[model samples]
Target chain A: GDTEPHARLPTCYPYGNLNVDELVQRLAQAGLADARVDDSKEGLVITLANDDVVIQINEFATHIISANSSLREKLRDILLECLGSF
Target chain B: LIMKNNSMKILGVNEAWGELGIVSHQLRFTERIEVEHIGPVQALTSSLHTLLSQKLGTTQVQVVSEYQLSVADSVVINIQDDNDDPGKNILLSWTHQDEALGSKLLEIIKANFKK
Candidate 1:
């Protein structure tokens, strides 16, 4: 438990007034198609192909990713491809 | 002091842990504290500061009082192996008077972080 279970992605660039739902949908479709997007107690939880990777988008619009170092970077790359630079 | 019942509502939990064993958690919440015991706003804020410092094990905590009146208080806590990224370090946020939630959270951390 002392060890962190997930790696976090940096905050995404401001979305301005873009709809979060639509944005997430587009992101999933673009690259995270294999990932499952569900609303958990942790806001939006994205389960990526790598079981270790978990992404959460909170109500405050902050995006956090958790995973091992290698997996985290890989996920970040994929996310950036979908969500753009964060 | 019998007053309105104010409890803390967990809005969200953002966590990021690295292979290096660094951990960071951002907990967002809404607070409705019964101010009867804590007295006025200023005093209540100070009390919250002390409480969080004790539970979180760091006086580095930073508090922002803007949302205290609206119940939209939040706390961003980052327990890391390194604190070089001063920019990302969480000082504090809005305050909550819910001792149970705070204690539970701390307990979870201790249970998990046993080293």
Candidate 2:
């Protein structure tokens, strides 16, 4: 019997007033592909989707990341690596 | 697969409004809260002062500044004080993301308004 996979709870981190394009590029550089951006009247919406992780950046300078529960540590490492570039 | 959002808005005694938005994934949480309709400026300030007095352990509520109260473990309530038109002023935000702490802060917010 297959066991249930743990849920990857999303977490949001505010990184000051960060430019959306810069973040997308950073993630893309980190091997996270399929980065998309939407600049609308409301604000900028950016999403970076891959098999291991999915990142959503809202207008409020908050980055919400969702990944597999088991990959949480790896995701953090990647995120910190990307953020450290800033 | 964790994506959920819950929001609430509370109207104060004098038409002041407070809105709370919670985005949860599994045990983690992210929230944004804003308060408008601050009743009277003096009254609201006094209320904030009193509310800020209720502390828990080493985590006492901190008055980060003249108009900001960092309550609970993670919630930060900032009051936008308007002298001439206090009622029109507001509490801009109390936001953070954490496990367990976020829900605890929500309770504190609800309790304050109930007073």
Candidate 3:
């Protein structure tokens, strides 16, 4: 069995802010034919599988558009920490 | 494969909320949930500081400036001064990926590489 861990990077836009379904569709349209998407209060969870690796993309787009512009640093830190956590 | 995500710390879930400074108390309130919660750049940086200190160990935290950097995985963590709680900052990087393989041999490097 070939079992290897894939690097999963999750980018979130909280507040039900991100259009999870639309993003999924866009990924498929953009040639990401094998992306799987899910949702939670925090945001969306996207999973992509390839021959050698599996990637998890989690994004919670900002609920408040006004706040989104300012939260970039915290968001970046949150993303990296989230990636490292798993 | 590399996966990346961004969001406020998960408020209600215990298992899912770690590394992002979501304490039980902080998680209780909706407003602090700050998922995409923003302010000026300084405010954002402050938020990041709080998150990093809570999730990771606090003493060695570093404060990051100028959000522009090629590599996004690393962060700036702030270390609090014991005297007055005025603090210093350090760059917090989860830079263990390469070091994790340090013990492996050159043959393993050539043979077992998965990427």
Leading candidate by lDDT: 2
Please give, for residues A1-86, the per-residue lDDT of candidate 1 as tens digits.
32322122324332222234564565565555556778788577766654444566664333434423344444434434443221
Question: Which portions of model 1 miss their true places by more than 4 Å?
Answer: A1-34, A58-62, A84-86, B1-115
lDDT of 1 by residue, B18-111 (tens): 2223333322222111123213444444554555555444433465452221111233433222233221111121212232333344444334
State residue A41's C-alpha deviation in candidate 3, in Å. Answer: 8.4
Candidate 1 residue-wise lDDT at B100: 35
Individual DockQ of the candidates? 0.03, 0.04, 0.02
TM-score-better candidate, 1 vs 3? 1
lDDT scores in order? 0.38, 0.43, 0.31
Q: In candidate 3 chain B, where is summed lDDT lowest over 10 consecutive residues? A: B25-34
lDDT of 2 by residue, B1-115 (tens): 2222554445532232112132221112223233444465556655656654542432446666666666543455555544544233323232333433434444555455522
Q: Clashing residue pairs in candidate 2, if any? A: A9-B25, B16-B37, B17-B36
Calculate model 3's interface RMSD in Å.
Answer: 15.3
Candidate 3 per-residue lDDT, tens place, A1-86, comes to 11232233323322222344555565466455676656655544455454111222334222211112123233233333333233
Per-model RMSD to reference: 19.1, 18.2, 21.0
Best of the two (1, 2) by DockQ: 2
